[model samples]
Target: MSFHYETPLVDQSELAQARAVMGAGMARILGYFREDGARSIRAIEEAFTQGNAAAMVIPAHTLKGESLQFGARRLGGIAESIEQTARRCVEQRLAPSEVGGEVAMLRGCFNETLALLESAAPPSGTPRPPMPGLAGTRPVTFGTAPRTFGRRTG
Candidate 1:
């Protein structure tokens, strides 16, 4: 079955912020996935399979944070669930199957997110003007307040 994502996973306004932060370094940002995303995904999956809940949680959380910063809404949404599940597992000693399910869901989410990002045209030669509320902003910090409308801040 297809994974169902919560609404507002990606906000168009956030895309503007991401483009502004990249500031002609868009290629470099996308390159991270081309180079190391696969490895990171594998590591996350491996951690989940091994029942290393903490490891799974850590990577998922990192991915979620990064994805949101980059305005990768789809990826961020999936990773958020994985992060939550991992957290729950760590806190309450959940079953391995539960973690496994979350990991599987995460894999699908990654694939879809990657596809969506790839399909989008790269940032234009002349960077578009930053969106309102995002102009003159600094790069987003991990686990900080969400910067877009329709998304939970903090």
Candidate 2:
């Protein structure tokens, strides 16, 4: 079954709430989300490649929740589709190929979602005003160097 998102790709309200709750910690959390989402996407793609329907569940499920945490509805919806379809395929002894197309689309959705998220995220490695007690100490942000959002092969 195909999925369409009724909501925006990224929900600003959810992000705003997260930012309000987390304050400056939002950058670190976004960094964690970026890393974790990529790893989970890789796992899901690898499982699909290996024809392991069972292996697809965890990563897809992980991606679904984490995507929602960042207000990424489209990515979360695609991931949920993968997770549910893979689970059904496993139960029915169907090949992972049943869910192959969605699996193939997963990374693209993730990249799109990441682009939106990164746009909303504070710039990593950019200098910020020093904290009250720590003069001349630039706040450290966690994340890799900026990427072009291109899908990595291999």
Candidate 3:
């Protein structure tokens, strides 16, 4: 495995694999990634603002893993960089200020990655076959609310 550093901004093969694994629900999975990624970016920013090097580790690490899962190599690379640098800073009792530039760049990377990810998602209104092994469940698709089977009672 070459790892995220050597990978492109988005590895199509890895993304295809993710698509294969996520099946009809891939769009929802991507949306969740976007939400989690944004939260992680904010956490990283907050850690930098507080000058808490240790605080950056968890969010950065989380971002790095999630990013890689979706083939967002550049975002993963930057998150890994922040995570590694923060770890060193914590070990050496230094501020995480050195990563200020990267911290600033994280949002932009995330936005770009979001675009790439969105583009990779299944186009709206694609028909979904029924999910296996889950009785009485509906497959969620984009641009519409998930289907409900039982009669509504509110």
Candidate 4:
């Protein structure tokens, strides 16, 4: 397999696979990736500040997996490097500062991934299908109270 360095910004094949599997839920899935990626970045920062090597591994690993899933090859590689470095620190074979540098690299890659994904995403006017369990429900308009199930509130 080619490394992230050689891979494109987004792997159409993986995205096609995701669309095939997720169907109408694909929109939400894409949203989740963006939200989660940002959250993972924060988590990594917190773990690094606290000197929690093991904790660092969790977010980096998560970011790596998510990036790969989204076809963000370079970002995935950077995250993977960070994850490995954090693992090494946890094993006492390396210093946390070593992982810190990798984190900086990851930040740059992450920003690129976000920009690519934003451009790839559907336009704002596109309508999203309701999620499962909320099917057939009407959306509450602005200035209107939310509807309750099986009862009405004054």
Question: Candidate 4 lDDT, tens digit per residue, 1-154?
Answer: 3344575766777755544445555567668887888899988888888788788888889998988876777788778887887888889855577666666666666877777765665554465544557778898767568868788878
Candidate with top lDDT is: 3
As for candidate 2, its clashing pairs are none
Model 2: residues >4 Å from true position, as ranges?
Answer: 5-7, 122-154
Steric collisions counted per model:
1, 0, 0, 0
In angstroms, the error of model 2 at 138 is 30
Q: Total backbone clashes of model 1? A: 1
Write one digit per residue (lDDT tens) for candidate 3, span 88-132. 999999999989877987898899888988888776556554344
The CA lDDT of each predicted structure is 0.68, 0.78, 0.85, 0.73
- Give per-model CA RMSD: 9.9, 11.8, 8.2, 7.7
- Superposed on all Cα atoms, model 4 deviates from the true structure by an RMSD in Å of 7.7
**What's the C-alpha lDDT at position 26 in model 2?**
60
> What lDDT would candidate 1 get against the real structure?
0.68
Mark the regions of model 3 whose C-alpha exceeds 4 Å error after superposition.
1-7, 124-154
TM-score of each candidate? 0.67, 0.72, 0.75, 0.65
What is the C-alpha lDDT profile of model 2 across 15-116, one tens digit per residue? 766555555666787778889889998998888888888999998998899888877888888888889989998999877887777777777777887877
Candidate 1 lDDT over residue span 38-137, tens digit each: 6667878888768777777777777878778767776776677777877887888874456565567666666666666555536557565575687688
Estimate the lDDT of model 4.
0.73
Superposed Cα deviation of residue 134, candidate 1 (Å): 11
lDDT of 3 at 5: 38
